[model samples]
Target: MYDHTKQYRCTIIRGKSKKEMDDFLPVYAKVIDEICPCSESEFESLFNNAFIRFLPESDRIKKTMDNHRTEIAGKLFGMYYRADDGIVYESERTQKFLEDNDQPAFFKDICYKMQFPNGTQKVGTTVRQRVADGICIRPIAFVLKVLLIAKQANVFITKREIGYYILNSLDVLQGNASPYEVFEQIVKDQKDGTERTIIVPGKATSYNWQHIKEQLNYLELANLIRFTDDKRVVLNLNELQTIELFAADYDKKPEFDVYSYDLSSLDGRKVFQLDWDYYFSQISAVSDQFATSAEALLFDGTVKDEQKSEGKPKPAVNLTAFGDEGESIVYEYEKKRVSEFNTRLANKVLSLGRTKGIGYDIQSVIAEPGDMAEFVKYIEVKSTKRLTCPDMNDDLWVDTLNVTRNEWIAAQQHGKFYSIFRVYFTRDGIFMFVIANVAEKLNDGRMTAVPMTYRVDFNKSSVDSVIVPQS
Candidate 1:
């Protein structure tokens, strides 16, 4: 419900405004004066260096500045003239100058502004000011606040715990109503399009807890946090401080204090119970979206298997009857399917099961029409039995399906040419899902890559198939 587009517009306008320059220039000048008195050109050089250091390494600030020098100069002049002369600003002259010359630096747009219910706007002094003031609607900042709370508590927290904490404390932190009272007002504003007011004690609308849980997933994808073996959310201590600083939009050390909590005394179960039924009801509304057998297998409680309870008898064919041999059936099926898809390249499809070091289970070729060329494709097939119950020991439900180090390395090396075939055996039939270029997805955080195996030191040649220690 947060208006991100409006927030972005506010940021850009604030960054490009005269007020921002006026606020920044004096502080910059004082810093330079403390070091050594310098000419305007020297001051500009020093300030530019200092500013660039605060920005992400990937930014194109220098190139943008060089390409738009004339427009930037004109805009600066217009701002300064209007402020010093105490006259109404003339936009036509500046617009004409900007149109005739190159545009201002692209980096100038990164700022923040806040709009109140009244027809008034508050401009941010810096690009990060909006984020620091908690006016920005970015999930990263909210997630960082969760981590900060966890850090202060010195304990790993769960997603449910974080959501409850935010629901209870965010309004209080912002100097609004108490946690119980705030959502009622928020819901009223959302429903009637009228400004919210103090409400008489009555039934309140339910809050969306899943939205907060999804934010935790975003943080995990960013590598700022990791799920422990016990499924608790653990902050990556090494990245925590750096992430906090970046989230706060701090150019150097933060000027403001981050919120902390005494979570040790807080009962997460009690807090979570207040809206548990409502949260599950919200989840149930979206249950139909996950129709795949794999999703059903992963979350047995929420995602019901379509094959079952439809009066369809279970298939007599047991996919996992022969263990690794059953997976061979899937590999054969994949090869046949690929061959059928491209009859011309069928002869080029080679089963790599006998080859141990190749990593992939199959290698196939796709014929390119109008050219005497063939594209090589590597496929890794993984077959699993129908999971009727959830695995209690695994942090992630999908961890039951394991990939060796060699297979992962091969996927990384082949990238686009590589694919993972996950075959799920259901009561109806074997359902196959293709994850093409899985390595690329994993690297980009689109897919999660959780480590599963641990190595033990051993001399392979020194031991026989069955090792018997001397008694």
Candidate 2:
């Protein structure tokens, strides 16, 4: 019994001498290597036995072994394990199973950490147990499942389709741009005294206004609006207060970017670059510290890629049919700088893009005409090159533009609309461009688009501006 106890304790020596442990160290090192592949230093230290006394495994050690086994399994499968819950959490959509159709405290914390663009509050408790287990499947599998369910629920409608549906229902509405643009114009017109209106529901405005009245009633119950005793409508203070309160709520609806448009080829899948989700997970683990200091989280920086060439020119003899081909192409690539600020902005935008209610997928990064959109002072990121810049365009570059554009556009349309900045990097390696005067100079184009021009100044460390550029 004593011998068994010692073995369980992980003690190598039993009724033996130092020579036995020395001999056993090599074999023990190999076993440890198999169990904990990631922490090589720890494994080696434990295996080397160059120091430290021998001891047997205690109950704690046994439990640790079990944990190691689970971690290994999860890592191999690219899944998350909640040891406390004894379940694996994979992609954001998979979380519904654990939510129990209602938000649970632990799951709510995780939801905020994920910053799900839709901001699902809790896991659905009714999720199939098998799915909650670590199941090997593609990320889109969850989308297909949700879409199938949404089809039945009649909520599969895209935002784009909603505009026409609503327009048809309106008595008199004029919006020629995109659906989102139309929605913006409607809201704008209502606010700026260009138009006074109430949104009513029905296939046609002439039909019975019952649905519209019902919607108003719903809004009344939510305290977002008040209807006259006769059933007409106007915004209520309580509704505005509730909007402000829930706006502060740490949750929203959930959505995903299927990237269905970019799947033109098999290799494109490898280059499709939307792995910021994983990076968001990393940032969320440390969100509390950054949230306390919002300014510290602001990113106003740059990244540069340097190229190095090797060797002098080799003899290049190549003719139509006569001789040796050109010398072998030789060059190397390196990342010049990665600032913490750049990372913070990228992570914040990424987290914002993942949010539920304000989920927006960025489409492209362009230079801002000015730091104002719709008369609101907005954050903007500028690029050194415009879409028409010939020399600056390249498919092989590892710049931020390619990685973030689509996601940003998506976020703006769906979730937290993000802003971008583009500036020409000066020869002195500083970002010194400004966009103040130009925004105010342009009037009609703010809501639509504008021509972008960036000046190069190597002297400035940061930008300061007061003028509100339109468009």
Tell me each candidate's TM-score: 0.28, 0.16
Tens-place lDDT per residue, model 2, 395-415, is 211122222344334324432
Score candidate 1 by TM-score against the native: 0.28
lDDT of each: 0.39, 0.25
Off by over 4 Å in 1: 1-342, 367-373, 387-400, 456-471
Query: Pick by lDDT: which candidate is best?
Result: 1
Q: Candidate 1 — worst ten consecutive residues by lDDT sum?
A: 110-119
Clashes of each: 2, 63
For 9-92, candidate 1 gives per-residue lDDT tens digits of 121111222323322322232222232233434534554564443234665387643322212322222211112222222223
